[model samples]
Target: MGKKKVSALVLATTMVLLSACNVNMGGGDTASKPADAASKPAGSSSSAPQKVVFWHAMGGSNTKVVDQMVSDFNASQNKIQVEAVYQGSYDDLLSKLKTSMGSSDGPSIVQMYEIGSRFMIDSKTITPMQNFIDSEKWDVSQLEPNIAGYYTFGGKLYSMPFNTSNPILYYNKDLFKAAGLDPAKPPKTYEELKAAADAITKTGKATGANFAIYGWFIEQFFANQGSDYVNNGNGRTSQATESLVNNEAGVKTLAWWKDLIDTKAANNLGRKTDDSKKAFSAGQVGMILESTASLKGLVDSAAGKFEVGTGFLPKPADAKEGGVVVGGASLWMMNNKPNEEQKAAWEFIKFLTSPKEQAYWHINTGYFPITKKAYDEDSVKDNLKKFPQFQTAIDQLHQTKLNTATQGAVMGVFPEARQIVEGAIEEVLNNKKSPKDALDAAAKEITTKIQQYNKTVK
Candidate 1:
């Protein structure tokens, strides 16, 4: 059989098995561990009604909201409980999962970034959520088809969506006013952005703009041009592993980035700090490309003195404005445990991603809502009037092509791939090499690593 057909068959079987097992998927008062499974005593049970442990990286004021959600879930339920744990950022969570999987103790549910999808699949340490959906005969219709595409492997959902976000253009109104440009208007195309950057730089208000991470920015750039960052977003669409980073689209995007740095309209800082955040916050940058997750931070840091506006990520002059990919993370269920623990984990997953849960998360954390129902919620609709930047994500999602590239980038060695690509961007900015040559070198190195990964995985 062909690779695609083989993968499809595998997915179909998993779904069939999942549907055969009858289970109550959503967490509620009646859903609990079987009597024999509830052998341990509860610790520090608060008023909130069964406490499943949830480890995530969403910290700061947003973490409080997660706790509140737990409290509310517990109060609403008499059987299953949720315990929220703030476990560092996405990278930290991956490392901790590695350690926890080796031992007996691990959180029932863990938060994972888009890249984690590969590791979770390789380890076979995560429960395919499609199983839970089928087992309980849950209404999958409530979730969008594309949302499942990001978390699925071999045709099954391995994780539930949570705290999802997308990239957008954040322009400084104060800079626009000083540049004699319309404060309400943001650059809608790459050509317009370059002109705006030059105009804004001439005003001496601040630098042109900053990108949080050059590689991620480049990925968005090509995505907007309808090019895949990595082989059709890691074969989620097809099994091809080709690299188009040296193509005309990629070369054009890379050259534009180099020009921005060469003209002194922008500065190249590694993704070490909130490059854009610090630049925009300190009034050193007039614009930035950043994740929608940073909306709250920008608003809070600006202190209402500066006007912050957001727009869809711009595309190349000739490209049909493709949409940006989603950021943030998802909830992954760990394997290597009893079915009862998995059952409990699935319950928490559903609870964390339900319409009510997603609405609360989007509003509280500034992450984009993963479900369409959240958009229908009056609370979310009302918030859009006050913080319209939040709606930029919705607009982008609608325009997005729903393909691998715009859905998300998939690379088994993504963390390493990013490091190499960033190094190339730096080389171009420093005049050490032309954008084409620099990316060519980086691509060669990355291709070697990709081959190594294929060998290892095979």
Candidate 2:
């Protein structure tokens, strides 16, 4: 690629304020297109585009892939520079955004998880993407149905969906064979899964299976059952105003989870996600309910030592698994910046969320592509055929519903609520509390939080 240039006009207005350091863009510029660099403003620069600081929480190989995308975007244009800074985990990024934005020292762009959507929506410090969409006349329909709803809030678009993933069932085929089960036939329902787990355990070949993030798993379960976990149309119509976790449907879901744990069909395995994964890799667990994003790590960790099979999460008896909610995170445009800076941020956001970039990101990060066009591409399909794990997630994607719960949950204190739910689940699993009691307590705690958040936001 030829050297891209940066516009002097953009450089004069844009400043990258990340960490405690200040990076200034000199008036002297290079001739580069806006698409070339991510961290820099896109007008035209002759020298290499100035870096636009991107605060992100992606780590491991996923981080490398994001950095590669930044590089790819940089090489494609000359007007702007994109600087991707690893900002620890999701919580770390949230902390940084909350603390730094008040001082105009936060990153221009940051990655926010799905759970953080409500928090961002409540914060007046974000530049809603709706304005940019209107200005650029970009097609929102180009995004994949399963993911598009996640970035939308109360009819306004605030973030760009980038890394999207869903929960899936990962089973060990060798364990299946030992239990006289067909490796090709994975469980389609909760009942079937229980039977499989029982048979696998009967052979005394492995420890019982486990699910990572039981709360997330349960949320998908409720969404599949057409049950709402909160009021206000599950927060799609209005912000969540009440708790639904203690309702009949939710009670049934919790009961089933309790039974799963009680029967030893699945272990509670508190959320050291990697430990549960390690158990699976060591052939100590026959089945694992893990995020689709963990597929890459599981595959690599197994290293051909076990036959791995991935499938959609099992459905409840009365309802088919409708749509697995999108997990992972998104990119938000920070407010408090000048109009020119916001425009430059919009350009970078557009480039990052483009179909081409989404496809590459999906392949590299093992997350689903956020655009249907990317998944429908010949290359993507061919790769899926070759890699069955990838195909399993794609199949699940097509079967999703776009309602609030399945589309994505929205609540002001979602992360806090999730932590509360996680603790309750742990208590129930450890036999310290009944499922009903545990969830009831969590529900009450979350409801108070929801009301508090509503009051605060209002």
Candidate 3:
């Protein structure tokens, strides 16, 4: 649990062009060592440690956690040194990573969002984590199946799940009580949620609810309805050639969301998650749908103001009860690196996913640990006790069934498809078009993009 100061030198160098790897080291200036060198394995000796560059998209408080974890890993080992680099947002990281391919300076390990799984696989520039696991015969039974399910396809885990999260319903318990609703009995189905929202609005306790118009949430709704986002078994059994977001489930989900906005039960926050979070934390909204990763921020923002409560995301009453897809990023090892570098990167990944490190990560950040063993750790248990709301996310994830819909849609153009979905949502909320029409148009466009992507990958 010791925090280490991140070297400014690494940050300064990392900000340079993505294609550049040369770092200017003053005479006798080796990479800054951790303050506690005693943590290094005893009697372990090696030549110059193999350096691994890790490019990640984590920012704000999450970036601090990544730096601390990297420092801890570096301190605990003597044969490998990892330089963690902040590579802007997830989209920015993907762009830069694509352009840096085939260059000698590309990162040895990169963190990409879950939606980019198919693209990473098709790029053919990644050494699938499954390859390493299979070669070493690593026992991965302890890994969270629901989280691993998203990154796994064709019976292989292409990337290592890190910073995994799932969406949940976060509500202001004080606001619920003021609205004459039981804070302990949060809404479970769409009908219940609507009723609660209406009561909350009528009582003037809060603005009922609000959530960002994000495609991820739409996808979750589809999953909750047991519907696929794309054909070809949600793009798991084979390559996805088209998008299925225009189906009946998609139409129903969008109609419900539009009704909520039109009825003034929920505010249309557009695509700015921060705006929605701000509204909820300020007690202006009774409930909000957001990733579990927002727990820490929401709690801190509402501290001494209101009590926060969390529950599984609401599903349609008529739909079969289903769970959510994992959101967040995963770690992928870059291909074509030197054997030593590849092995070193894998070692760092293994260390990061270990029970102790995962527990520390889960406690510090709101992200769920990918390993089941992490929850059994004393540190994790203590943190869970302090904030029992965190356990709701675990329970929600545990209830998730391993199915095509829950595995999430996979396509080379998934990022673009998400943007299209968001655009369609805006159209519906703005009353420019009905849900079915908007979704149909979006599905058509996404299908074309997917077909084009398939051709290229083929």
State the lDDT of candidate 1 residue by residue for 1-458, as single tens digits. Answer: 00000122232233234335432232322322221334332321344333467888776787798888888877765667777888776656666666576355777778877755665565555666776787667777677555665776666667787777667888888888889888878888778888888888888778887775556667778778877776755456643355567777778877887788778777677665476678888888888887777787786788766888788887778885466766556787666555555675566666766778778888888877777787888888887877877777677767677766666667556666666777887777778999889888877877776555554444
The residue-by-residue lDDT of candidate 2 on 1-458, one tens digit each, is: 00011221221121112212432221112211112224334454445444466888888777898889888877887766788899877756666666675566787778887777776665556766776776557798887867777778767667888787888889899999999999999897778888998888888988557876546777777777767778887888888887777666566766666677788777766776777888999889999888887787787788768888987888767773367787877887766555545566666777877767877877777788877778666667666765668678878877777777677667776666666777877777677987788888889988987786676555
TM-score of 1: 0.84
Candidate 3 Cα misplacement greater than 4 A, ranges? 1-46
- Sorted by TM-score (best first), the order is 3, 2, 1
The per-model lDDT (C-alpha) reads 0.69, 0.72, 0.81
RMSD of each: 8.3, 8.5, 7.9
Off by over 4 Å in 2: 1-51, 376-379
Model 1, residue 345: distance off in Å is 1.9
Q: Against the correct fold, how does model 2 do in TM-score?
A: 0.86
Q: What TM-score against the true fold does each predicted structure earn? A: 0.84, 0.86, 0.89
**Order the candidates by lDDT, highest first — what do you get?**
3, 2, 1
Error of 3 at 105 (Å): 0.8
